[model samples]
Target: MLSDDELLRYSRQILVQQIDVEGQLRLKQSRALIIGLGGLGSPVALYLAAAGVGELHLADFDTVDLTNLQRQIAHDTQSIGQSKVDSAMARLAAINPQIHLRAHRSALDADSLAAAVAAVDLVLDCSDNFATREAVNAACVAEGKPLVSGAAIRLEGQLSVFDPRRADSPCYHCLYGHGSEAELTCSEAGVVGPLVGLVGSLQALEALKLLAGFGEPLVGRLLLVDALGSRFRELRVKRDPACSVCGSAHG
Candidate 1:
């Protein structure tokens, strides 16, 4: 049951016919894990926290650097050198004290990552690297959890959802079997701040839709954002039966 304050705080969201009181309650009971607290994770965490996702698990081993200020909105100048997880937790706590926040300050290895995914109802892969994305996808497939993945680099962004519980939905491995040999990080390629913010905000919206059972998620589609031209395109994606990570699990 929501407290009087919760009702008032989320009244605007609840008023939306698609996300009425029932959906708000569902949001209050869902637990989500957000991996990474950088550009994409920043907005993802903020919106989910504000929307009242009951428990949010924040995982990031990096620390705030001066360069992060341009895109990582969760941390400010005072947070330089502070752990990203700690910084994000502080920001999220301030946004909504009612929601629970968990921290994973250390880098998660295979076993730890599996454990983390197993503990959550859903996962948001705000991670930047291909390796981490593959690992998280494998973990989600093994744990039968839904994953909302988003990435932004330079002026381009992509967003998708993979639900292992659904037969037709493709896992990250299915989409990018072995990823690119030369994947670039934001620091290396440079990204526009608003590009990541846009992708992250979409990631958060997909999470809410999944958690609250309100709308269609990007389960079998990939949304591409071209910031330079301000164009949005979506491509249809399908599960790869031979996908090493999710093939046998789903089969």
Candidate 2:
């Protein structure tokens, strides 16, 4: 049940036809896990919190650096040396004091990751690097949870959603083979600040739609953004029958 304060606090969003009282209540009951607190994770965390997700578990092993301020909006000069999860938590708490925030200051191992995935309604893969992305996909597949993955590097950004519970949905490993080893870093490649913000904000939007049972979630499609060219494209993604992570043989 939403408190009178909650109803009033979220009155503006609730006024929308798609998210009236019922959707607002669902938002207040959803639990989401965020796998990173950097560029993409920053806006994802903030919007989810402000939109009234009941519980948010933030996981990140990195600390804020002076360079992060350019794209990581949740951290500021005062939080320069603080842990990313801690810095993000502080900002989220300030945004909506009613929501629950859990901080996981380190990367999760296989067993711990499985446990964390099992505990959440959905998982957001905002982490950088292929290794972590693969690990997150494996855990979500094993636990049959939906995974929202977003990445931004240089002037390019991509977003996708994979629901392991849906047999037809493609997991991240299906789109990018398990053997692929390409790894890119923003520090080395240099990402525009707004690029990540745009992707992260869209990530939050996908999450809200999924949670509230509203518009279509990007279950088997990937959206690509070319910030330099100022254009967007969509690709139809298919599940690989040979996918090692979510294949019949794996099951």
Candidate 3:
């Protein structure tokens, strides 16, 4: 049951046949945990908040440094020295103060990470390091939660979603092998700001689709954006039977 103010707030989305009132209500009941409040996480948090996700659990141990201001649109110069979660909460609150905001100023460990993923309906892996990504993926797979993963380096970005609840979906380790290659992240490689925004927004879209139960979510497709070369390609990804995360029986 939508209140008068709720109807007005979500009128645009409700007008869409795919969404209507039901989808809007689903959005209001969704709880999303977003790890890493950096470039890729910025747009994801902003859009999800604006879309009215009932609760947001933001985890990031980093502070709002000057280097992050370029693409981390959720933070400003004033946010410097502030916890990333604090900065994100302020921005998300401004977007939709009606929602619940849970700010975690500390990094997520194994136990806390499990709790966060299990509590949320979905999780977003916005961390740059492969370690954090793997941790988030493992938690998602263990909890049978949908996970949205995105990344941007230099002028390239990639987006994918893995919902263990969906049998055909593949986890992150399925797409990217669990290798020990050193990652070239934005801080070291210098990313084009818009590229991060583009991919992060895509991550947000897939997350919203899953939350609202509308349209086909990006279950097993990897959408890549090569802004430098101005090329876009869709890569097919299949789950690994040997994947330790969501494989047949996790061995």
Best by lDDT: 1
Instruction: Tell me the tens digit of each residue's lDDT in model 2 across 1-251.
Output: 99999999999999999999999999889999999999999999999999999999999999999999998998999999999988998899999999999878877999989999999999999988899999999999988889999999999999999998787899999998854555768888899999999999999999999888899899999999999999999999999988888887235
Summarize candidate 1's per-residue lDDT along 80-145 as a digit string, tens digits: 999999999999999999999999999999999999999999999999899999999989999999
What is the C-alpha local distance difference test score of each model? Answer: 0.95, 0.92, 0.89
Each candidate structure's TM-score, on Cα atoms with residue i matched to residue i, is 0.99, 0.97, 0.96
Model 1, which residues run further than 4 Å from truth? Answer: none
Candidate 1 clashes between residue pairs 3 or more apart in a chain or in different chains: none
Superposed Cα deviation of residue 58, candidate 3 (Å): 0.6
Error (Å) of candidate 2 at residue 231 is: 0.6
Residue pairs in collision within model 2? none
What does candidate 1 score on TM? 0.99
